[model samples]
Target chain A: MSAVVILTPAIVAGWPTIVAAVAGAASALGLVVKQSVKQDIDIAQQTQATEQTVEVELAKSEVVAQNLAKEKEIVVTKGDIELSVSRDERGRCKVCAKGKGKTKAELKQIAEQFAQKMAQCFVYNRVATELKNKGFQTVNEEVMEDQSIRINVRRWVD
Target chain B: MAQHDVEIVISKTGEVKVHIKGVKGKGCLEYAKWLSKIVGSVREQKLTSEYYEPEVKSKIDLHQQLNDE
Candidate 1:
Protein backbone atom coordinates (compact mmCIF):
# COMPACT_ATOMS: atom_id res chain seq x y z
CA MET A 1 0.00 0.00 0.00
CA SER A 2 2.87 2.36 0.41
CA ALA A 3 4.48 2.35 -3.01
CA VAL A 4 4.52 0.61 -6.37
CA VAL A 5 7.37 0.58 -8.82
CA ILE A 6 8.01 -0.83 -12.30
CA LEU A 7 11.52 -1.68 -13.35
CA THR A 8 13.40 -2.90 -16.39
CA PRO A 9 16.27 -5.14 -15.35
CA ALA A 10 19.86 -4.35 -16.25
CA ILE A 11 22.11 -7.41 -16.30
CA VAL A 12 25.51 -6.69 -14.81
CA ALA A 13 27.51 -9.61 -13.55
CA GLY A 14 30.65 -11.68 -13.84
CA TRP A 15 31.16 -14.48 -16.37
CA PRO A 16 30.32 -17.23 -13.90
CA THR A 17 27.12 -15.49 -12.95
CA ILE A 18 26.21 -15.00 -16.57
CA VAL A 19 26.87 -18.64 -17.31
CA ALA A 20 24.72 -19.71 -14.41
CA ALA A 21 21.86 -17.62 -15.65
CA VAL A 22 22.28 -19.03 -19.12
CA ALA A 23 22.11 -22.54 -17.71
CA GLY A 24 19.00 -21.68 -15.76
CA ALA A 25 17.32 -20.22 -18.82
CA ALA A 26 18.27 -23.18 -20.92
CA SER A 27 16.73 -25.57 -18.45
CA ALA A 28 13.54 -23.52 -18.26
CA LEU A 29 13.20 -23.47 -22.01
CA GLY A 30 13.91 -27.21 -22.32
CA LEU A 31 17.09 -26.63 -24.28
CA VAL A 32 20.22 -28.77 -24.02
CA VAL A 33 23.64 -27.31 -23.52
CA LYS A 34 25.67 -28.53 -26.43
CA GLN A 35 28.89 -26.72 -25.64
CA SER A 36 30.41 -24.48 -22.98
CA VAL A 37 33.62 -22.64 -23.77
CA LYS A 38 35.23 -21.62 -20.50
CA GLN A 39 38.73 -21.17 -21.81
CA ASP A 40 40.11 -19.22 -24.77
CA ILE A 41 39.87 -22.15 -27.13
CA ASP A 42 38.57 -21.51 -30.61
CA ILE A 43 34.85 -22.23 -30.75
CA ALA A 44 33.52 -24.40 -33.51
CA GLN A 45 32.47 -22.51 -36.59
CA GLN A 46 28.85 -22.56 -37.73
CA THR A 47 28.36 -25.52 -40.06
CA GLN A 48 24.96 -24.56 -41.45
CA ALA A 49 25.34 -22.20 -44.37
CA THR A 50 21.71 -22.20 -45.37
CA GLU A 51 20.30 -21.75 -41.87
CA GLN A 52 18.67 -18.47 -40.97
CA THR A 53 20.54 -16.67 -38.20
CA VAL A 54 19.28 -13.96 -35.85
CA GLU A 55 21.05 -12.12 -33.09
CA VAL A 56 19.35 -10.48 -30.12
CA GLU A 57 21.28 -8.21 -27.82
CA LEU A 58 20.15 -7.54 -24.31
CA ALA A 59 19.74 -3.86 -23.47
CA LYS A 60 21.12 -2.15 -20.37
CA SER A 61 23.43 -5.07 -19.74
CA GLU A 62 27.14 -5.22 -19.05
CA VAL A 63 28.83 -8.58 -18.82
CA VAL A 64 32.01 -8.05 -16.85
CA ALA A 65 34.97 -10.13 -18.00
CA GLN A 66 36.11 -11.11 -14.54
CA ASN A 67 37.39 -14.68 -14.88
CA LEU A 68 36.25 -14.66 -18.50
CA ALA A 69 38.68 -15.35 -21.30
CA LYS A 70 38.88 -13.43 -24.56
CA GLU A 71 36.34 -15.82 -26.02
CA LYS A 72 33.57 -17.63 -24.14
CA GLU A 73 30.36 -18.96 -25.54
CA ILE A 74 27.51 -21.18 -24.41
CA VAL A 75 25.76 -23.09 -27.13
CA VAL A 76 22.36 -24.63 -26.52
CA THR A 77 19.98 -26.51 -28.76
CA LYS A 78 16.25 -27.19 -28.93
CA GLY A 79 15.25 -29.53 -31.74
CA ASP A 80 16.60 -27.93 -34.91
CA ILE A 81 17.21 -24.50 -33.39
CA GLU A 82 20.65 -23.68 -32.06
CA LEU A 83 21.24 -20.81 -29.63
CA SER A 84 24.61 -19.40 -28.80
CA VAL A 85 25.05 -16.92 -25.94
CA SER A 86 28.11 -14.77 -25.59
CA ARG A 87 29.34 -11.35 -24.65
CA ASP A 88 30.22 -9.07 -27.52
CA GLU A 89 33.45 -7.13 -27.80
CA ARG A 90 31.75 -4.26 -26.04
CA GLY A 91 30.80 -6.53 -23.11
CA ARG A 92 27.14 -6.65 -24.05
CA CYS A 93 25.13 -9.85 -23.78
CA LYS A 94 24.04 -11.34 -27.09
CA VAL A 95 22.04 -14.37 -28.15
CA CYS A 96 22.31 -15.76 -31.66
CA ALA A 97 19.80 -18.29 -32.97
CA LYS A 98 20.18 -20.34 -36.12
CA GLY A 99 17.90 -22.98 -37.50
CA LYS A 100 17.41 -24.60 -40.87
CA GLY A 101 13.98 -24.39 -42.44
CA LYS A 102 13.08 -21.51 -40.16
CA THR A 103 12.44 -17.97 -41.32
CA LYS A 104 14.32 -14.93 -40.12
CA ALA A 105 11.36 -13.92 -37.97
CA GLU A 106 11.27 -17.30 -36.28
CA LEU A 107 14.94 -17.22 -35.47
CA LYS A 108 14.60 -13.69 -34.13
CA GLN A 109 11.76 -14.71 -31.84
CA ILE A 110 13.76 -17.67 -30.53
CA ALA A 111 16.77 -15.51 -29.82
CA GLU A 112 14.67 -12.90 -28.10
CA GLN A 113 12.94 -15.46 -25.93
CA PHE A 114 16.24 -16.93 -24.81
CA ALA A 115 17.61 -13.46 -24.05
CA GLN A 116 14.59 -12.50 -21.96
CA LYS A 117 14.68 -15.75 -20.02
CA MET A 118 18.35 -15.28 -19.32
CA ALA A 119 17.73 -11.80 -18.02
CA GLN A 120 14.97 -12.99 -15.73
CA CYS A 121 17.18 -15.70 -14.29
CA PHE A 122 19.99 -13.24 -13.76
CA VAL A 123 17.78 -10.73 -11.95
CA TYR A 124 16.19 -13.37 -9.78
CA ASN A 125 19.53 -14.74 -8.67
CA ARG A 126 20.90 -11.28 -7.87
CA VAL A 127 17.84 -10.18 -5.94
CA ALA A 128 17.61 -13.38 -3.94
CA THR A 129 21.24 -13.17 -2.87
CA GLU A 130 20.93 -9.52 -1.87
CA LEU A 131 17.73 -10.00 0.09
CA LYS A 132 19.25 -12.82 2.07
CA ASN A 133 22.31 -10.76 2.88
CA LYS A 134 20.12 -7.88 4.00
CA GLY A 135 18.29 -10.06 6.54
CA PHE A 136 15.02 -10.20 4.65
CA GLN A 137 12.91 -13.30 5.14
CA THR A 138 11.04 -14.73 2.22
CA VAL A 139 7.42 -15.11 3.20
CA ASN A 140 6.08 -16.56 -0.02
CA GLU A 141 7.23 -17.42 -3.50
CA GLU A 142 5.52 -18.82 -6.54
CA VAL A 143 5.68 -19.07 -10.30
CA MET A 144 2.67 -17.91 -12.23
CA GLU A 145 1.09 -19.54 -15.25
CA ASP A 146 2.73 -16.97 -17.47
CA GLN A 147 6.21 -18.02 -16.28
CA SER A 148 6.59 -14.95 -14.11
CA ILE A 149 8.03 -15.22 -10.59
CA ARG A 150 6.41 -13.64 -7.56
CA ILE A 151 8.16 -13.27 -4.24
CA ASN A 152 7.15 -11.69 -0.94
CA VAL A 153 9.74 -10.71 1.59
CA ARG A 154 9.57 -9.06 4.98
CA ARG A 155 11.91 -7.61 7.57
CA TRP A 156 11.64 -5.88 10.87
CA VAL A 157 13.20 -2.46 11.19
CA ASP A 158 13.85 -0.60 14.38
CA MET B 1 9.50 -2.43 15.63
CA ALA B 2 8.18 -1.64 12.19
CA GLN B 3 7.52 -4.44 9.72
CA HIS B 4 8.30 -3.70 6.09
CA ASP B 5 6.86 -5.89 3.38
CA VAL B 6 7.93 -6.00 -0.24
CA GLU B 7 6.37 -7.96 -3.04
CA ILE B 8 8.33 -8.40 -6.25
CA VAL B 9 6.90 -9.77 -9.49
CA ILE B 10 9.39 -10.53 -12.23
CA SER B 11 7.71 -11.08 -15.56
CA LYS B 12 8.76 -13.58 -18.21
CA THR B 13 10.30 -10.74 -20.17
CA GLY B 14 12.43 -9.76 -17.15
CA GLU B 15 10.40 -6.68 -16.30
CA VAL B 16 9.83 -6.16 -12.57
CA LYS B 17 6.92 -4.73 -10.60
CA VAL B 18 7.44 -3.99 -6.90
CA HIS B 19 4.85 -3.28 -4.24
CA ILE B 20 5.99 -2.05 -0.85
CA LYS B 21 3.56 -2.17 2.04
CA GLY B 22 3.59 -1.25 5.77
CA VAL B 23 6.19 1.43 5.23
CA LYS B 24 5.61 5.18 5.20
CA GLY B 25 7.26 8.44 4.14
CA LYS B 26 10.96 8.26 3.48
CA GLY B 27 11.12 4.65 4.61
CA CYS B 28 9.17 3.64 1.54
CA LEU B 29 11.59 5.53 -0.65
CA GLU B 30 14.46 3.65 0.94
CA TYR B 31 12.99 0.32 -0.11
CA ALA B 32 12.28 1.62 -3.60
CA LYS B 33 15.83 2.82 -3.98
CA TRP B 34 17.29 -0.44 -2.73
CA LEU B 35 15.14 -2.50 -5.08
CA SER B 36 15.90 -0.28 -8.05
CA LYS B 37 19.58 -0.66 -7.36
CA ILE B 38 19.32 -4.43 -7.32
CA VAL B 39 16.94 -4.68 -10.28
CA GLY B 40 17.42 -1.73 -12.64
CA SER B 41 16.15 1.73 -13.53
CA VAL B 42 12.63 2.56 -12.48
CA ARG B 43 10.23 2.85 -15.39
CA GLU B 44 7.33 4.10 -13.22
CA GLN B 45 6.54 4.77 -9.56
CA LYS B 46 3.42 5.54 -7.52
CA LEU B 47 2.99 6.52 -3.90
CA THR B 48 -0.21 5.85 -2.01
CA SER B 49 -1.79 7.49 1.06
CA GLU B 50 0.26 5.30 3.38
CA TYR B 51 3.44 6.77 1.98
CA TYR B 52 2.23 10.26 2.86
CA GLU B 53 1.37 9.31 6.42
CA PRO B 54 3.67 9.97 9.38
CA GLU B 55 6.62 7.61 9.56
CA VAL B 56 6.44 7.04 13.31
CA LYS B 57 3.00 6.85 14.93
CA SER B 58 4.52 6.56 18.41
CA LYS B 59 6.35 9.84 18.01
CA ILE B 60 3.15 11.63 16.96
CA ASP B 61 1.29 10.11 19.90
CA LEU B 62 4.01 11.25 22.33
CA HIS B 63 3.93 14.78 20.91
CA GLN B 64 0.13 14.92 21.31
CA GLN B 65 0.36 13.74 24.91
CA LEU B 66 2.90 16.45 25.75
CA ASN B 67 0.71 19.11 24.12
CA ASP B 68 -2.31 17.98 26.16
CA GLU B 69 -0.31 18.05 29.40
Candidate 2:
Protein backbone atom coordinates (compact mmCIF):
# COMPACT_ATOMS: atom_id res chain seq x y z
CA MET A 1 0.00 0.00 0.00
CA SER A 2 1.21 3.47 -0.75
CA ALA A 3 -1.05 5.61 1.46
CA VAL A 4 -4.07 5.58 3.68
CA VAL A 5 -6.62 8.37 3.92
CA ILE A 6 -9.41 8.94 6.38
CA LEU A 7 -12.23 11.18 5.25
CA THR A 8 -15.57 12.35 6.59
CA PRO A 9 -18.23 12.53 3.90
CA ALA A 10 -20.23 15.71 3.46
CA ILE A 11 -23.76 15.29 2.09
CA VAL A 12 -23.96 18.32 -0.15
CA ALA A 13 -26.07 17.51 -3.18
CA GLY A 14 -29.23 18.44 -5.03
CA TRP A 15 -32.65 17.26 -3.91
CA PRO A 16 -32.81 14.58 -6.61
CA THR A 17 -29.51 13.13 -5.54
CA ILE A 18 -30.57 13.26 -1.91
CA VAL A 19 -33.79 11.47 -2.77
CA ALA A 20 -31.87 8.78 -4.59
CA ALA A 21 -29.74 8.18 -1.54
CA VAL A 22 -32.82 8.13 0.65
CA ALA A 23 -34.37 5.48 -1.57
CA GLY A 24 -31.22 3.40 -1.42
CA ALA A 25 -31.05 3.79 2.34
CA ALA A 26 -34.66 2.82 2.75
CA SER A 27 -34.15 -0.26 0.65
CA ALA A 28 -31.07 -1.28 2.60
CA LEU A 29 -32.93 -0.89 5.89
CA GLY A 30 -35.98 -2.82 4.68
CA LEU A 31 -38.23 0.20 4.96
CA VAL A 32 -41.14 0.65 2.59
CA VAL A 33 -42.08 3.98 1.06
CA LYS A 34 -45.49 5.15 2.13
CA GLN A 35 -47.79 7.39 0.19
CA SER A 36 -48.30 10.99 1.32
CA VAL A 37 -51.74 10.30 2.78
CA LYS A 38 -50.56 7.19 4.53
CA GLN A 39 -47.58 9.05 5.93
CA ASP A 40 -49.79 11.88 7.18
CA ILE A 41 -52.16 9.41 8.79
CA ASP A 42 -49.31 7.55 10.43
CA ILE A 43 -47.79 10.72 11.79
CA ALA A 44 -51.17 12.00 12.90
CA GLN A 45 -52.05 8.77 14.68
CA GLN A 46 -48.69 8.78 16.43
CA THR A 47 -49.00 12.43 17.45
CA GLN A 48 -52.49 11.78 18.83
CA ALA A 49 -51.00 9.37 21.34
CA THR A 50 -47.92 9.76 23.54
CA GLU A 51 -45.57 8.70 20.75
CA GLN A 52 -42.09 10.18 20.63
CA THR A 53 -40.53 12.07 17.75
CA VAL A 54 -36.84 12.56 17.24
CA GLU A 55 -35.03 14.70 14.66
CA VAL A 56 -31.45 14.21 13.51
CA GLU A 57 -29.73 16.62 11.16
CA LEU A 58 -26.75 15.99 8.93
CA ALA A 59 -23.64 17.83 10.03
CA LYS A 60 -22.15 20.69 7.97
CA SER A 61 -24.17 19.70 4.95
CA GLU A 62 -26.80 21.15 2.64
CA VAL A 63 -29.13 19.85 -0.07
CA VAL A 64 -29.03 22.71 -2.49
CA ALA A 65 -29.68 23.40 -6.22
CA GLN A 66 -33.06 21.78 -6.88
CA ASN A 67 -36.13 23.77 -5.93
CA LEU A 68 -37.97 21.58 -3.46
CA ALA A 69 -41.63 22.42 -3.12
CA LYS A 70 -43.09 23.35 0.22
CA GLU A 71 -44.23 20.46 2.41
CA LYS A 72 -42.34 18.04 0.18
CA GLU A 73 -40.75 15.14 2.03
CA ILE A 74 -40.00 11.44 1.65
CA VAL A 75 -41.58 9.18 4.22
CA VAL A 76 -40.76 5.54 4.82
CA THR A 77 -42.25 3.03 7.20
CA LYS A 78 -40.77 0.00 8.93
CA GLY A 79 -43.32 -1.80 11.11
CA ASP A 80 -44.76 0.77 13.54
CA ILE A 81 -41.92 3.25 13.02
CA GLU A 82 -42.13 6.10 10.54
CA LEU A 83 -39.14 8.01 9.23
CA SER A 84 -39.49 11.33 7.44
CA VAL A 85 -36.49 12.53 5.47
CA SER A 86 -36.66 16.16 4.48
CA ARG A 87 -34.64 19.29 3.97
CA ASP A 88 -35.25 22.18 6.29
CA GLU A 89 -35.38 25.87 5.34
CA ARG A 90 -31.62 26.07 5.79
CA GLY A 91 -31.24 23.33 3.19
CA ARG A 92 -29.86 20.87 5.74
CA CYS A 93 -31.00 17.26 5.58
CA LYS A 94 -33.08 16.10 8.52
CA VAL A 95 -34.40 12.72 9.54
CA CYS A 96 -37.43 12.55 11.84
CA ALA A 97 -38.51 9.32 13.45
CA LYS A 98 -41.82 8.75 15.16
CA GLY A 99 -43.26 5.59 16.61
CA LYS A 100 -46.10 4.84 18.92
CA GLY A 101 -45.29 3.14 22.22
CA LYS A 102 -41.62 3.96 21.76
CA THR A 103 -39.45 6.11 24.04
CA LYS A 104 -37.64 9.26 23.00
CA ALA A 105 -34.34 7.42 23.20
CA GLU A 106 -35.62 4.68 20.94
CA LEU A 107 -36.87 7.17 18.40
CA LYS A 108 -33.60 9.04 18.55
CA GLN A 109 -31.66 5.87 17.92
CA ILE A 110 -33.80 5.00 14.96
CA ALA A 111 -33.42 8.47 13.47
CA GLU A 112 -29.66 8.42 13.93
CA GLN A 113 -29.39 5.00 12.34
CA PHE A 114 -31.43 6.09 9.35
CA ALA A 115 -29.32 9.21 8.94
CA GLN A 116 -26.12 7.21 8.97
CA LYS A 117 -27.45 4.74 6.43
CA MET A 118 -28.52 7.54 4.13
CA ALA A 119 -25.11 9.17 4.34
CA GLN A 120 -23.37 5.90 3.60
CA CYS A 121 -25.53 5.23 0.58
CA PHE A 122 -24.92 8.74 -0.70
CA VAL A 123 -21.16 8.42 -0.40
CA TYR A 124 -21.09 4.99 -1.98
CA ASN A 125 -23.11 6.06 -4.97
CA ARG A 126 -21.08 9.22 -5.53
CA VAL A 127 -17.71 7.51 -5.16
CA ALA A 128 -18.55 4.50 -7.26
CA THR A 129 -19.86 6.62 -10.09
CA GLU A 130 -16.81 8.84 -10.02
CA LEU A 131 -14.47 5.87 -9.96
CA LYS A 132 -16.14 4.27 -12.93
CA ASN A 133 -15.98 7.55 -14.79
CA LYS A 134 -12.26 7.68 -14.10
CA GLY A 135 -11.86 4.24 -15.77
CA PHE A 136 -11.63 2.19 -12.59
CA GLN A 137 -13.29 -1.22 -12.50
CA THR A 138 -14.61 -2.88 -9.42
CA VAL A 139 -12.51 -5.83 -8.26
CA ASN A 140 -14.60 -6.72 -5.26
CA GLU A 141 -17.34 -5.29 -3.08
CA GLU A 142 -18.76 -6.46 0.20
CA VAL A 143 -20.45 -5.31 3.36
CA MET A 144 -18.70 -6.04 6.60
CA GLU A 145 -20.22 -7.27 9.84
CA ASP A 146 -20.14 -3.70 11.19
CA GLN A 147 -22.35 -2.56 8.28
CA SER A 148 -19.44 -0.80 6.63
CA ILE A 149 -19.02 -1.15 2.85
CA ARG A 150 -15.70 -2.24 1.40
CA ILE A 151 -14.97 -1.79 -2.29
CA ASN A 152 -11.81 -2.78 -4.11
CA VAL A 153 -11.17 -1.31 -7.53
CA ARG A 154 -8.31 -1.38 -10.00
CA ARG A 155 -7.23 0.43 -13.13
CA TRP A 156 -4.41 0.08 -15.57
CA VAL A 157 -2.45 3.31 -15.79
CA ASP A 158 -0.12 3.49 -18.72
CA MET B 1 1.37 -0.81 -18.00
CA ALA B 2 1.04 -0.45 -14.24
CA GLN B 3 -1.94 -1.67 -12.24
CA HIS B 4 -3.20 0.73 -9.59
CA ASP B 5 -5.47 -0.67 -6.89
CA VAL B 6 -7.57 1.19 -4.34
CA GLU B 7 -9.47 -0.15 -1.40
CA ILE B 8 -12.17 2.08 0.06
CA VAL B 9 -14.02 1.34 3.25
CA ILE B 10 -17.02 3.47 4.12
CA SER B 11 -18.07 3.08 7.72
CA LYS B 12 -21.65 3.02 8.93
CA THR B 13 -21.23 6.58 10.09
CA GLY B 14 -20.20 7.73 6.61
CA GLU B 15 -16.50 8.06 7.41
CA VAL B 16 -14.28 6.86 4.55
CA LYS B 17 -10.98 4.98 4.89
CA VAL B 18 -9.02 4.77 1.65
CA HIS B 19 -5.97 2.58 1.00
CA ILE B 20 -4.12 3.11 -2.27
CA LYS B 21 -1.99 0.19 -3.46
CA GLY B 22 0.27 -0.81 -6.36
CA VAL B 23 1.17 2.83 -6.90
CA LYS B 24 4.55 4.07 -5.74
CA GLY B 25 6.09 7.49 -5.12
CA LYS B 26 4.20 10.64 -6.13
CA GLY B 27 1.66 8.80 -8.26
CA CYS B 28 0.01 7.44 -5.14
CA LEU B 29 -0.35 10.96 -3.81
CA GLU B 30 -2.18 11.92 -6.96
CA TYR B 31 -4.68 9.11 -6.39
CA ALA B 32 -5.10 10.15 -2.76
CA LYS B 33 -5.71 13.74 -3.79
CA TRP B 34 -8.21 12.71 -6.42
CA LEU B 35 -10.12 10.51 -3.98
CA SER B 36 -10.13 13.23 -1.35
CA LYS B 37 -11.69 15.62 -3.87
CA ILE B 38 -14.36 13.06 -4.70
CA VAL B 39 -15.14 11.92 -1.16
CA GLY B 40 -14.94 14.97 1.11
CA SER B 41 -12.70 16.72 3.62
CA VAL B 42 -9.69 14.66 4.69
CA ARG B 43 -9.51 14.11 8.41
CA GLU B 44 -6.08 12.45 8.28
CA GLN B 45 -3.59 10.96 5.82
CA LYS B 46 -0.50 8.74 6.16
CA LEU B 47 2.21 7.69 3.72
CA THR B 48 3.50 4.13 4.02
CA SER B 49 6.92 2.64 3.26
CA GLU B 50 5.88 1.74 -0.26
CA TYR B 51 5.42 5.42 -1.02
CA TYR B 52 9.19 5.99 -0.51
CA GLU B 53 10.24 3.12 -2.77
CA PRO B 54 11.69 3.98 -6.14
CA GLU B 55 9.24 3.96 -9.02
CA VAL B 56 9.71 1.41 -11.78
CA LYS B 57 11.44 3.08 -14.72
CA SER B 58 9.83 0.70 -17.18
CA LYS B 59 6.40 1.73 -16.02
CA ILE B 60 7.19 5.38 -16.67
CA ASP B 61 8.65 4.51 -20.06
CA LEU B 62 5.58 2.44 -20.91
CA HIS B 63 3.34 5.35 -19.95
CA GLN B 64 5.41 7.70 -22.09
CA GLN B 65 5.23 5.31 -24.99
CA LEU B 66 1.45 5.04 -24.64
CA ASN B 67 1.20 8.81 -24.60
CA ASP B 68 3.38 9.12 -27.68
CA GLU B 69 1.25 6.62 -29.54
Q: Of the candidates shown, which would achieve the greatest TM-score relative to the real structure? A: 1
lDDT of 2 at A11: 91
lDDT accuracy of residue A120 in candidate 2? 95
Using DockQ as the measure, the top candidate is 1
Interface RMSD of 2: 0.7
- Every candidate's DockQ is 0.79, 0.71
Please report the candidate that would top lDDT against the real structure. 1
Tens-place lDDT per residue, model 2, B1-69, is 889999999999889999999899988989888888877889999999999988876544444345554
Q: Candidate 1's residue-wise lDDT over B2-49, tens digit each?
A: 898999999998999999999989888898899899999999999999
What proportion of the real contacts between chains A and B does each prediction keep? Answer: 0.94, 0.95
lDDT of 1 at B9: 95
